[model samples]
Target: MNTPSPARWRPNRYQIVTISLALAIALAFSVFAFQDFRQGQLAFRVFNDEIEVLTTLANIQRHQALMFAQTLAWLDDPAAGKTEIEKQRTFLASQLRVLRPLVANEPEIEQRINNLQAALQEYDRLVESLGESPSPQARATARPQLIELLRRVDEALVKRAYDAQERSFVLDFGNLLRNQERARALLFGVSIAFILLVLFASGLYLRSERNTFNLRQRQIQELQAAVNDRTRALELAAGVSQRIAAIREQSQIVVEVVEQLKQTFNYYHAHIYLFDENRENLLMVGGTGEVGKTLLERGHKIPRGRGLVGRAAETSQPVLVPDTVADPAWLPNPLLPETRAEVAVPIVVGNRVLGVLDVQNNQVGSLSELDVLLISTVADQVGIALENIRSNQVVERLLQEYQQLIETSPAAIGILDAQTGVFVQANPQMLEMFELTPADVGQVGPIMLSPERQPDGRLSQEAAIEHITLALQQGKNTFEWVHHTRSGREFRAEIHLTPAPNREGRPMLNAIITDITARYEAEQQARRRAERETALNRLTQAIQGALSVEEALQITARELGQVLGRKPVLAALQSTLLSYDKEDQ
Candidate 1:
């Protein structure tokens, strides 16, 4: 009555023959497709090459026109235009050279390019001759000839060459289109034949598949399950990566990672234990739930290799215990008394293991190889986050030290945004020197600290920006600046602006300003003293060399008058009263 399960429906020879025919047709179609693709690619390459050649020729033509303009510009202002003319001439020559190679395949184009080069050389000779002319009259005479030569080159050489290349490109493009159409037709026929063969083969295949449909369906289901599990693992890794990356604190990263793992994977308990400085003990640093809090409060510690966490940390490897109760090394914690299975993955950075990420479940054998793999991946992310946090902490410490140093420094120091020319930070000494408050820090620009005009007669704002720009370009600048304070008191400042590395990795200007007014005044005093000494020496010499008392008095009076910037009257009591007033005499 069962009818032998519908004769078992075994495949016959017809199905095999149909499958062979289908495969052959498919192979033929594939070959046709490959040929068609290759033909299309060749057509594209040909079109691109043509376009490149046309573009090069066009660029050369444009440069030639620019060269002509520059030549005319030279006629207007020879001194300024000569340099630009020479540069344009050099560029045009280089373009000609580039075009020469591109058009080498076409004899007409190549000949045209050669003629163009010859014309360019003649033009350059004329320009050079014009430059060497002794007077503008001779240059004026040569201008007509230069213009004629430019017109001839532009029309005969560049224009003709472009037309030739364009015609060649059109012909090549037409041929390529025709070849592509032929390939497409052949591909279409082969594809149609392939589709019909495939349909016939599929009919046979469907008849054969009905007998083993249940078995194939089960296999598909298993494969889909595996795919879903892999997808889920990837999604979890992505989520954990994002969460940990945002956390820059080592302890916080650990805590967030553990909590995510427990919630995402529905593990009974999750804990993170970090290695102590001595690398001898694993201390619970972060965990999930009240159980985690209790363990953390108890300051639970385990020596290396003492339990799952310790083993993972010590070996820098993952450890899974399917049945903690059956494992000899399993150390049951009072907080997680119901834990039946445990997995530990090391949180490692480079060659060193920083900690272990442990997950526990209440069901025995609940953790599989996939669970271990996923948790281990998350542990790696946690390790990277820890490394980043440690690096940030180190940078923060260094920054604090630097800020303290700047604050205590005697020289006035300020940090200015290089782009905006605005002050971002100022030290105490800087604030006092500028007579500025902390509130004025960000509101001020480099010019605000300078007088209306500099000692050199340059506008202070313009000069400051110029020097700051120079510092940014060259990395440092040191100059004497006249700065006006809030009280309208002008003083000399020796400013050293250096490019400082900022937190955002951008270049900022560090202005180290030192008041040099007193030093300048002292220099002036020393000069004046030297001048006074010289004047006294000259007066003494003149008096000593005088012939008589009156002469000496006259000499002394004249010398004293010169030194004092006024006439002096010298009187002497002798046999007859001797007197000399240098201005009156």
Candidate 2:
């Protein structure tokens, strides 16, 4: 004899707790798997670095052994031997210089490299000391030093090999494969466990809900026409969710939302009110019926804290009114005189209230808290969809603006691959500054654009890598660099480098270059001018101590020639026979 309720639609508490616990356990496993994956990657990278260092160092030693043997064979023909050995020494020294940046993090390896380099220079000096056609004794004398150099190479290489092998054993590339397998096992286990948990929860939910669902179904079938209409509206509303994700138009979204609500719930009228640009007032965006159209045409608006819609927006909560005629909070409109019940749900995104969705009915007590909950669900979907469109639009606009800025910038800009040390992108200014075209610079190495050595006596390739590592590891770096054009014109540049990730999330180096050749030349000229003045003053004082005028004049002329650097300065005695006049005078 008692009418059944709408099945008290809500989830079971015990099922929610069980599912939440299972999800928490899965999340914890996922985090551990991610950490193991990262550790494996680090081990693999370290293995590659160890191999590179070992291989490069081994090549250097082999090259040295070959040079020494070849030079010994050509010893009888000293001219041939000297020329070949000098070329070989130059190459071998470059290899040693390159090792500095490679073993930069290993002090022990760097020290060994330094020792090898010093021994190589000594060998060069001993070879040079042997004349073009040396006697047997001279060759014999230089032979011991050559043997000593070979011994040093052997020691350095052996020590380096031993150290690298030890480190490789600790962190091998094999660990990467093992970690990957473990990650797969963990993922499979978690997936199986979660599936079983879902199945158990679903069974319990279905069994508990069956009787309640049947009771509500029997009680709700009185109005067949209303049921068919509401069912049709719900189908249209289902499509709205998919459309909301893909569609970008704001007005079209809200219009469809309001129409669906009015048709689906048997409401007399429905409309959506969104905050204006300043957010001080809520402007009606979309509404149903002729009365709704007139109000929209006249620009219907509600200020904050004024009406039921404003109250919902301000509080970020739903407002429901049954029998609006008895509630002073409901501001009745003459156009909606039959509206006895009303509800408004605030559309919220994050913590900010963007708008309100309002619905009115013709019968008192027709709208309830259940209707407020229904409208809130729709409002939440709209908020999520609008936010997605806004984010995508903002990101696209920012990308375009950044691309334009990089293209038009006056300073020479370059982007280098962090892993390969290659020039990947060069702006027009960068190409012009290097006297290279796009084709000439693409995929080229930093060493290819630099001279053999810098003005400061460091190898250009080594210095370039040092500065690049500093930027990539320490966030940023600024330094002076020496580069050369294809035609062999060397120039100085001030390089500013910053680290940023590429589209693939790999680290990349961004550079801004300014030509500092003119400034550098100016500084050199000032330094030489100061040196010349100092020499001139010293000569003047020395001349005052000379015993004879002619002697004093001779010393002054000779010193002037030396200080002025190869320019002739003559002091010719005049007929008066007391003083020497300048040659030009």
- Per-residue CA lDDT of model 2 for 290-324, tens digit only, reads 98799899999999878899999999999998989
Q: How close is every model to the real structure, measured as TM-score?
A: 0.57, 0.47
lDDT score for candidate 1 against the true structure: 0.75
lDDT of 1 by residue, 275-333 (tens): 88898899999889987888889898889988888888877889999999999988888
After superposition, the stretches of candidate 2 with alpha carbons farther than 4 Å from their true spots are 1-270, 278-280, 287-300, 303-306, 314-317, 325-340, 348-352, 360-367, 370-401, 420-426, 435-448, 456-461, 486-489, 541-585
The number of clashing residue pairs in each candidate reads 0, 0
* Ten contiguous residues minimizing lDDT sum, candidate 1: 571-580
Q: Give me the displacement of residue 515 in model 1, in angstroms.
A: 1.0
